[model samples]
Structures are given as structure tokens and as C-alpha cells.
Target chain A: MTRLVAIDWGTSSLRGALLDADGKVLEERSDARGILKVPQGGFPAVFEALFGDWMGLEGARCLISGMAGSKQGWVEAPYCACPAGRVEVGRSIIDIDVRPGSRIAIVPGLRDEHDGVPDVMRGEEVQIFGAMSIAGLDEGVFVLPGTHNKWATARKGRVAGFRTYMTGEFYALLSQHSILARTLDADAPLDEAAFLDGVTRSENGHGLLHNAFGTRTLALFERMATPELSSYLSGLLIGEELRTQSLQAAGEVVLIGASALTQRYALALRATGTATRTLGAEATWAGLHALSGFLDADRNPP
Target chain B: MTRLVAIDWGTSSLRGALLDADGKVLEERSDARGILKVPQGGFPAVFEALFGDWMGLEGARCLISGMAGSKQGWVEAPYCACPAGRVEVGRSIIDIDVRPGSRIAIVPGLRDEHDGVPDVMRGEEVQIFGAMSIAGLDEGVFVLPGTHNKWATARKGRVAGFRTYMTGEFYALLSQHSILARTLDADAPLDEAAFLDGVTRSENGHGLLHNAFGTRTLALFERMATPELSSYLSGLLIGEELRTQSLQAAGEVVLIGASALTQRYALALRATGTATRTLGAEATWAGLHALSGFLDADRNPP
Candidate 1:
């Protein structure tokens, strides 16, 4: 029997997994039904349509994370202040009114306001907690690579602080919309050498705004081919992120994300003389599972 | 008589000026007809439509600069190597065939192959040459700010060496396409304080990939208003460009570009402790006219 339903509802995609009481995932499903593309029936209706069987089941709870918790999401789950963990996130879950007599809990995102500038993350917080749980560590730096890459520090089983970098988003914009697009091959395979070369360039301390011109000049001079330009750009961006962020202080960096991007980050980090460990999407599942434990405790106090 | 038609044909716009035999401006005109927008009739047809009367005038020659010399322009006016001045640029102009027995010369761009990567500029070279002519500087650094900001060094009245920074292009992409776009007010008036704040941030030695995130967080936390974000971003990018390109050695920097942008660069350079002198787009006219002199000389030997 399905004990719980965990969903990662992001900006552009929705992923759901049904888990047993022991937290073993029984079935998984995903769709392009992101919050940005909700159907005529609103988020509740769309959630029902996508996970009908799992819903309305007796004693089975549904947990949601990611942008679904934002102001633009199904229900605004106000962010919990940072230096938080599973209990902090769990206690902050807000209920969503839905049909079929279901108990739906939306995981609140984490916010770090100490930096003078407010930085917040919804889905990545779950990944952070999950990576911490999986790595069996109480303190570490977790690098979650995505459209907006996140760098979170975990201390004593709680997120200490984190910052967001628009690395992937800027890469997409540069590769697709800027003049540098003229010299890139979007469809080409990853060129590791060029990507590493970009990482090497980043290490030189030449600011990114200046080094980026090399993307064109290198191609123009035949020093780097068009196909390699994409990877080189990727390396440069990720490398700069590593160079500037305070991720080096952590003993071992934990990279949690999809393998393709995580691998690239790992390569960049390793090249910079830092060791990294990779965790897949299951880390999110594990994080959601751990947070669900808090929900169960709230529903039934000992 | 309309002695010469000097055109600055760039990627997105075309500007033309009519001059007499003594290089005095007779009339000026500009249009959105950049090389990127030529219709099915081709460049000659577009040129004729834009400047019809001046084209067929007796002894009215045409001189074109900028991307009109690029591979995608009307005809590729190959780049003249650096350590070159008016004479080199003039001799390198390639002829374009048009109606009315007209003689048209497209100015060659400059290429600096001294650095491992090849750096090239087309119309800006004309402006640099023009700035030299106007300021009477035999040697100095001339910064031409635009889509691709060029930092050119002149020694003995010739372009010594230069570097290209994608500052403007990167700013455009970040403000219009990246996630930070949501926090910016593109139509807002310039904010000098916020812009200087960005310059101050650049001085902290944090790489741009890290600094750019401030645009988002500051706005999110209400520390920076939307309108101010644009100028702050501008300062951040321009500051990075100035920091990385090594323009400090020159005694006095000559900034040649549009007034508004040059003013901003002037502020940025000043904040960085460097003095600047501004030159308007008339410099391009002067450079093209000086280059046009070469064509007249070829017609009637000295």
C-alpha cells in the first residue's frame, strides 16, 4: 500500500513518487505539468489528474516541494529561516485544500537573510537535507547545480547558509541569445578538453566579463572549434562559480543533482583541487521522506 | 557638391554622412538598415534606397566602415593587422560595385593577433583613428564602448594592441534574458548611486559570476529598487571590464562612443581612479573622412 506520495513540483516539470511506510519508493511518475503550465482546473485539479490512484487513499499523505511552495504556487508556504533542518521544514509545511478528503503538506523553502541580501531555495533545500542524510554527515557543503545553482552549508544536521548563482541560466542566455551564440554548436557533444580549458581560464583570476570574449576570439583564431565552444563556456562559468564561492572551506563537497551536470561540476571542482561526491535525484526522495517523518509526528504526538 | 558619403554600417544600424572635398559635413542620415536586415534586393539596393540622390552624384564617392566589412556584410573588407593607422586602413578598403558609376570604399577592420586569441574591430577602428586625429594624440589608450567594447592602445598614431570585452553584450543578455531580468527596470532612468555601488562591489575582487547575483538578492530583500538595478548591473559589468582589461597604464584614457554610454564609462573609470576624456560619434565621421582622403589621393597621385 502507498504510505506517502512525494512530489517535486518545479517551474517547468512535475515529478511524483509513491512510497511505502518504510520509505521505499513503489512507483514513480513525472510530467511537463509544471506550475507554469497548470491546466484549466488549477493546481489541485491537475495534481489529482496526474496522481489520481495515489490520492484519496486512506491514511496515505501527499507531500509537495519545489516552486509549488512559492507565492505563485498552489499555496504560499512561507519560507523557514535558515540554520534549519527536516523538523524546521516539516513544521513549516502548509496544508492545501483538495478534494477526496486528502491531507496534503507543502514543504516550505529555506531563506538566508544574514547575507544582507535575501537568498531562498525551495526544491534544493530538500536535496540539501537529503544529501546530508545520505552522506551520513552533520556538516558539509552541498553544491546543487541547476538553472540557478545553489551552494548550501550544513552544520549540525541543519542548513547553515547558502547562496544562489545564476550560472546555468546565464549559460543558457549566452548560448542562445548573445553574439557568442554565433560561434557555438549547441548540438555538439561535450568537449571535455575545451571545458577544462575554460576552467583553466577561470583560474587565472581574469574576471568573467572579460574572459567571456575568449569564447569568440578562441573560435575566431581556430584555437577552439565551434563544437568545443559550448563546453568551454560551461567550464568557464562553473569554474568561476567555484573560484568565487566559499565552497573550498568545506572538507569534501557533496554535489546533488542530475548526473550530467553534477559530473561536470565534479570535474570542475576536482580540477580546482577539490574533491566531490555525487548524489542523484533519489537524494531528493530521501530528503522528502525524512521531512515526512516530522509530519507523521505532528499528526500523532507520542 | 556631395564629395563623399561616409557610412558606419554596424550589426543593427546604419549611419551615413555626406561631406565636401575638405571633409566638412554637408548632411547626415541614419537608419535601422544594418547589414543584418538587407532585403532580397541586397545591400546595393538598400544603399540606394537609403541614400539615393547622393549615390549617383558626380565625383560623390562612398566610404563605408564597421561590419559592412565583416563576412556577413555586403562584401568582406578584410581586417587590416594592428600597428596600423589611416594609411593602412585606407589602402585596405575594398571596392563595392553599385549603380551610377559610383566608387564606394569599405574600410577594413583591425585585427590584433598579438594575444593568443585574435581580437578584431571594424567601425571602432575608424573611430579610434578619428579620435587620434581629433585629439592629436600620437599614443594613448582609446576605449570605444559598444556591443563589443574595445580597448585600443595607440603608439606613434597607430593601433599598438587592443582587447575586446563583451561587457555590453553580456549586460544586454543578463538584463533581458537571464533570471535577473525579473528584478530589473529596463526603461527606468539611470541611477548613478546604485551604479557606483556596483562599481564599489567590483572593487571587492569578487568575480562577476558571484557579484551578479546581488542584482537579484538586493531587489528581493528590498535593498535595491528595480529601477536602480539596471545601472547597478551596468556598473558591475563595466567595472569588471575596466578591472580585467588593464587600461590603467595609459596616462589619459580617451573614451569614444555615444554620449550617454561614454558618460557612464567615464563615471566608472573615474571611480576606479582613472581620468577620462570623451569624444562623440563625430570621431567616426572624422576617421572616415580622413580615410576618404586616401581614396582621393589614389585617384590623383601626389
Candidate 2:
């Protein structure tokens, strides 16, 4: 029987999963009602439309993550500072009333201000927890690849700290708005060789600003085809992301994200002389399950 | 008496200087009729409206440099490849008829393909020539900072090879479009101390992808104010540009560009322990004069 509804409502998309008490997904739904698109005072309506079917189950509760817990979301869950674990995160969850007999809990994001640079992440914290528990790793580096890719350290089943590289966002802006946009083939498949070439090129002593021009110059001289440019650019960006944190110099990294992005990052990491393991979107389920379990134990005092 | 019209028609603006045969300016005009704003088949009209006053003088020939000679400009003066000197460039100018018995010559841009990364420059070649001639340097590195900064090797009065770094363009894009945009003061003056702090941070061995996050982090933490972020970003980009070319390791650099930009680059170069001499926009005048003199000497057989 369904006992919980889990929603990963980010800035641009909404994803929901109906789960049993055992943390197994019974049914899933995804839509475009992300926090940014939700009309004012319409969060409850949208949430009901997406997952109302599962709400009839006895004692069913809603647990939402991602930007839905942000300041702009339905409920503002203040960020929990690191080093935090499932217990801390569960304790920090902000409760909200959705209807007369229904309720929702929004997970708070995490912030790290240790390195003199403020770094924060919302949905990825739970994902990291799931990745760590599933991988059976006591401590390691976790990479969640997306618009703002998160690189976090999991020490003794707790998140110590993490840094964010706006690699994916930078890639999007450059590919769409910069001069290099004209020379790109937007629909081309990934060319592995070109991607690896760009990965290797990232090791060039010149910085990224200098290296970015290579995209244009390569196309101008016909050294690299327009279709291949995108893959190469992806490699360069991911490679830089890896280099920034010295991830390759670290022993191993567990990549948590969609399959496609993780695969690209895995390829880049391996090419850069690092080992990698991957966990899919299921990691979020496992992470949220652990947090919900913590909340249950806390409430019953057993 | 006016014998030559030197025009610097770049991507956004056109600058014209009427000059006597002795290479001294007699009058000048500037307008926003850059190549992008020109309507199809309307280049002659725009040129006339801007520089028509000086055209009535007898034997006044226009020597046009910059984007007016690009493929999208009035006439495509093909790029002359490096190791090209003034003579090679002078020979490559493509002439066009603006009116009956009135002709204009467009200077060819330079391209370097030696480094496997194709690099090209248009207006800077003229500036470099002027900087070199004025400095009386037979061989040195010349840095021309602008939208696309060029670092060219000048050896014995000819361009040997060079590389292009998209430093300024990256700054503009990040300041205006990226997440870092909110952390910048659009109208803030250059903060020298903050700028140097950024230069110091760039040497931390972390790549730019990692370093860029510091902008957001600094502002978020309130360690660095929002208004100071722009200068810091400028320092980071300029520092990376210098680091890529090992410009800091180079003993001295001739900076050729507008005074404001060159001053910033000069500060970065000096902080990095390199000596710098700045040549203002007048270098463009000097460089164009040299090229026109070469053309006249070739035609008169003197």
C-alpha cells in the first residue's frame, strides 16, 4: 500500500513518485509544474492533480524536495548547514498544511561556507544520501551532474561539505548566446573521440577563457566539424569541473544524476585517470526514504 | 591638404580621421554605423554620410581597417596568413569603387594557424604595427585587449604567430547573462584592491570553472561586496589570459588598445611581475599610416 508521495520539484520540471513503506516506487508522475511555473497559491492544486490518486491510502503523507522547498516554493524550508546527516535533515524538514486532512513536509537544502566561498544545494543533498547508502560507501566523493553540478564529501554517512561548478549552465549560455553558437549542430549525437579530445585539451596549461576560443578556431579552420563541437565542448566543461576539485587526483567518484549526463561525466573521469561509479534517479528515492524513516523514528520516540 | 582618409570601422562603431600626406590628422568623425547596423547594399551611403566632408579634397584615398573588410562588411579582404609583414598586408588590401573615380582600400586581417588553434585578428594588426614602430622594438610580445584580446609575436617588423583569448567577451557575457550577473555592479568603477585579490586567487591552481564560483560565493558570504565583484571578475579573466600565454613569465609586454582596458591589463601584468608599456588608440593611426605609406611607395615605384 502506498504510504508516501515524493516530489522532486525543481525550477523547470516536477517529478513525483508514489512509494510503499518499503521505499519501493509504486507509480511515478512527471510534469511541467515546477516551482517557477506554479501559479501563485496554486501549489496544492497542482500537487493534487499530479498525485491525488495515492492520497486515498491510510495515513499517507507527502514529502517534497528540490526547489519546491526553496524560498519561492510553496513552503520556505530554511537551509541546514553542513555537516549534516539524515537525522539533521529530517529534523530540519518544514511541515506545511495542504488541505483539511492532508499534510506535506519540505526538505531543507544544505549550505557550506567553509572554503570562504558560500556553496549551496537543495535536491542533491537527498540524492547524495541515497547514492552513499546504495553504494555501501562509508565515505567518498559524490558528483551530482546537472545545471549546477554538486561535488560533495560524504564522511561517515554524513555530508561534510560540497562545492558547486556552474559548468552545465555555462555550457548552455555559451552554446546558445555566444559566438560559438553559430558553429554548433544542436541535434548531433555525442562523438566520443571528439569528446575525449576535448577532455585531454582541458589539461592544456592555458585557462578556460583561452581554451573556449578553440571551439571557434577549430571550426573556422575546419579542423573540427560543427557537429562534433558540442561533444567536445561538453568534455572541456566536465573536464574543467573535474580538474577544479582535483577529482581525478582523488581515488574514486560516485556520479548521481540522469544516466546520460553521468555517462558523459564517467567517460571524462576515466579519461582523466579517475575511477567512477554511477547511481540513477532512484538514488533520490532511497535518500528520501532514509530521511522519512528518520522522521518517523523522531515522531514516535521509539 | 588632406591626402588620406583613415577609417577604423569595427563591429559596433566607425571612426574616421582625415589626414595630410605627412600622416597627421586634420579632422575626425565618429558614428555608430558599424557593419551590423548597415542595411544591405547601403554601405556606400553610410560611409558618405559619415566621411563625405573630407571626400571633396583632391586625391583623398580612403584606407579602411577593421570589420569593414570582413566577409560581412562592404568588401571581403581575405585574411593574410602569418608570418606576414607590412608589405604582405599592403599587397593584400582589396580595393573597391565607392563612386566614379573615388576608390577605397580595405586592409586584410591576419590569421595564424601554427598552434593548431586557428587565431585571427583585424584592427589589432594595425595597432600592433603602430605600437612596435613607436616603441622601436624589433622583437616582442604585443597584447591588444578588447572584445577579443590578441597576443601576437612581433619579430623584426612582421607578425610571427599569435593566439586569441576571449577574455573580454567572457567578462561581458558573465556580467550580463550568467548567475554572476546579480553579484556585479553594472556601473561600478574599477576597484583596484578587489581586482588584485582576484588575480591572487587565480594563482590558487584551481581552474576558472572552479574559480568563477567564488564570485557568487563571495557575494553570498558578504566577504566581498556586490559592487566589487566586477573588478574581481575582470582580474580573474585577465589573470587567466596572462597565465595561458605565460605573459607573467615574459619579461615585458607591449599593450596596445584603449587607455582604460590597457590600464587594467597593465595593472594585472605588473602585479604578476611583468613590465608593461601602453600604447593608446593613436597606435591605430600610426599603424594605418605605415600601411598606407607602403601602398603609396609600391604604386609610385619609389
Candidate 3:
């Protein structure tokens, strides 16, 4: 596998790792080119300022992933659909002529329809494929929980498809912007009992899309505490979500997408059933590494 | 019984009706001095502008209810506790050393604790009795659905007490200010099955708060139409509310409060159960009328 430039560019920052053919990080530098900040003279200046000093970067090839490939980022490379195995994701690179740096290419993100639902991803597609490597590539489910949590299914080391749920974002907005916002403990953690209770309730035929405002009633007339009410609200959401996705996900190993914001979901899933395990953000490095290998293999047939 | 005055003043408008010796609308007038706007304006201008012609309103005593009697309204008056029948809801009959011809007495609204929960009411106390009148004034549960849907229990024409849920206000905020707002059908009636479906779903167990984002999920994943989703969401919220309150209410008739908003709630209730009925907003008026009769009986020594 030829060593080139590795990039993990997300919404708030651009991180580039200069690697050797052996996939060793020789030197690394990062800049603020997050998706949210791109409109303010993003990716180009940041990439230049951070990697300009790496001599090997002058002629080496470039492989990038993350939101930097989004329509709003450094170079808008439309996402590629899956069966993406790292090689296709990392190797099908696109060039950003904005800067002079040998042969440059960006790893395409992932988007596909699964079970009649449309799904999408930007930088994390590479990481997902990467994580599949160390975790051992096989048929399974991969999750990345956040404001917009992604749940993807892969078979034979190729991502079959994925879907997105704005549960976290909705929770955040309702917890802070609307009337319920006044009652939320913005910093509180999940109430496990509440989550388990939610799961328990769902099994009894409770539906998420049917009943979300039970939170206020519980608090107002029932006199349930605020924190507990919030947890219950989250539980109903996560519970309903699990109910929606679980049938198709049975027996598939649940690879929880972890970040600080996702711990609650991880906890909820534990009680809600469906075998699961955790992989942290740092694992994205592994995802990046695996993508590099896939890119190499794709470019040179055995 | 001498004829008196009737008033219905709210957040944005002031309505005054001068009744005759038999409690008929002799003359009426209204203005834009809802409490939120003229918080500092005294009642003289408001009353004069509307009922100025009745300066010599002979044999006329006036009775008033609403925010006009709030702490910030014309004259500050404390609330009367529940189970309170025909309590003066406004400032006492201070002679108009200032007004000259009318023995003006503002009916102070009622307030009270019911079932260990803190509760209060102002303009609606009379409406409670009015509704109770139709519901048999026997022991039963009464619901005044609106921006603050009140669930009150009454025994023999007196308000036992009630709990307020910000159902209407919440529906407004969510559908207009929050993302859920995007799903509403500008032309759809509240009678849509989807709305009732939401109410049913609310009662389904996971409850309303659980299914709050169902509209969004359905739209995003299935490309479900918006107006249908809106009706479903509405049903979901109100349904959860009804479910919770039903349990809390036990076995009592749901005497609904009146207004455009209350009517929709009545429709939703009719779709679900027969224990619900819409009550007039003028029960407070009739109760005040009854109170006026009670007052007259006291004065005449029957």
C-alpha cells in the first residue's frame, strides 16, 4: 500500500496526517476547517497553513474524507454509494486544484437506500469502513450516535446501506428552545430506569410517533420531577426508534457509534436489547488507516 | 333580580355588554385594551370608551370577570379558592366616589387546591358553573381545553378544583416556532383522522412525548406527506393528554371549556370517547348571574 496524505475533516476542524507507506503517522497538523466554518475562508487556507511545512507533502498523493468533501466544504465531491469497502471509499479520490500538491483525491462519502429508507454520511463513512477492519469485517450493523445518528448495515465487509435519525437534535431543540426547554437539565445524563422503562413500555405496544408529549402531563399533573421527565422523553424517543429499526437489526452485531453525546443511546440500547459494543471517536484513525489500505489495494490489483 | 353587566376581556381585546333588568344585552362595545397591551391603563378609560353611553345606566349593577381583575389589571384582587361557588372574582363593590351612577362590583375569580394539587381560576369560574349547568351540576369532571386546557372536577355546581396544561400554547409553539411547525396544514380542519390518530396514539402507552417527532421521521424516511403528518402529530399530542388525564380523572364527565380551540378538543374527544362534552365560556357569567341572584336574595331578605 502506498502511503499518502490522510485527512479526517469534519464539521469544525480539518486534521491531516502525513504518513509513510507503512501507514505510520510521521507528522500531523490540523486546522479549523469544520463544515460549519467553511463559509469563512475554510479548507484551502487551513490545509495550506497546516501542511505547507511537511516536505513530503509536496509531491505525495492526497486522500481526504469528512464534511470537507461536502457541497459546502473545500472541494465538493458527491458521495458514492456503498459496497464501499474502504478501498472504494478511500481510493476513488477527487482533486482539489485550489492548492498545488501532487496528485490529489478526496474519498467519496456514502449515501444509499436501505429497506426503503434513504441514508447519508460524509466523513464517517471512511471511519465506519475503517472500524469494520480492526473489528473484523463481516455482515453487521454500525452506529454513530450524535445530533444526527447514523445506523448502517454492512454485509461481506461492504456497507449495504444506512439511515439517519435526528433524535438527538430534536431532543436538544425541544429541551432548550420550546416550553420544555425551561424544564430540562441540559447537562443531566440518562436515567437508566427511565430508558429501561421506555423499552418496557414499548414492548407493551407503546409507539414513539404516537406519544411524545406525555412528558409534560407526567410533570404537571403527575408531579414527576423535571430530570426524570426529560429522561423519560429521551427514552420514549430512543425506545420508539429502536422499535422501528430493531426487527431488521436482530442478530446483527451492534457497533455503537461513540462520542461524548452518544453515551446515553449506548446505555439505552444496552437495556433495549440487540447485542452491542462500543467504538470511540479515536477509532476514526483506524477507519482512516483502513481506508488508505483499501485505496492502495484498489489502485493496484494483486 | 336587577339587570347587571357582562364582560369578556382577554389578551388582545376588551368586550363589554350592558344587560337590562332581566340580564339582557342592552348595549355593548369593545376595544383593543387586552391585558397584555394596556397593562398600565386604568379601567375608567377602558370601561368609558366601551360603555360610556351607560354613564347613567339606571338600576344597573355591573359584574366583570377576566384578566381585568388580575393583579396587573384595573384593581388588584386576590383569587378565591376552589369548591368556591359564586365568589366575587374581582375587586369589591367600592362605590364609584369616582364613577357617579353604577354600583360597580367586579367578581373576584376563584382559586383552590384539588386533590393535593395547587390550582386557580379567574374568568372561567362562571363558565365552570355554566358548563356544570348543562352537565347536571352533579359531581363530574370538566375540561376547559385551550392555550391552557383546564381539567376541573366539580361537585354540585361548584368547582372542586382544576389543573392547567399548556396544551394549546405548546401545540402553537411546536407547530409554528419549532421544526414540527413546518408540518401543519394551513387548510386542514382539526377533524382530520390523522389528528385523531395522533390523539389515539397519545393514548397508546408510549404517550405523546414519545411520538413527538414521528411526523419528522415519517417525512424524512418515507417521504410522507406533510399535512397528514401534521394531523397525526396533533392527534398524538392531544391523545397522550387525554390518556393521562383520563386516568387522573377516573370516572367523571369531561365538560369542555369553550372557544375555537376548545371546540377542536371537543371534536377530538368525541372521536375517542363519549364521556366528553363542550361547556360554555359563560358559566362564569351564569354563575356570576347566580351569584347576583344570591346577592339579591341577601339584599331582599326573601
Q: Pick the lDDT winner.
A: 1
Candidate 3: misplaced stretches above 4 Å? A1-302, B21-32, B54-56, B87-121, B182-188, B203-210, B221-223, B247-260, B293-302
Off by over 4 Å in 1: A39-41, A99-101, A221-223, A297-302, B55-58, B97-102, B296-302
lDDT of 3 at B18: 65
Where's the lowest-lDDT run of ten residues in candidate 2 chain B? B293-302
Q: What is the DockQ of each candidate?
A: 0.62, 0.68, 0.12
Task: Kindly list the per-residue Cα lDDT of model 2 for residues A94-186, writing each as its tens digit.
Answer: 887766676678999998874466778899999988887788876889999988888899888889988787888788877887888889875
Best by DockQ: 2
lDDT of 3: 0.61
* Per-residue lDDT value at B40 in model 1: 41
Sorted into a CAPRI-style docking class, model 2 comes out as medium
Chain B alone: TM-score in each candidate?
0.95, 0.95, 0.83
**Of 2 and 3, the candidate ranking higher by DockQ:** 2
Off by over 4 Å in 2: A100-103, A297-302, B297-302
Q: Which stretch of 10 consecutive residues in model 3 chain B shows the poorest summed lDDT?
A: B88-97
Kindly indicate the candidate among 1 and 3 with the higher TM-score. 1
Query: What is the DockQ (computed on Cα atoms) for candidate 3?
Result: 0.12
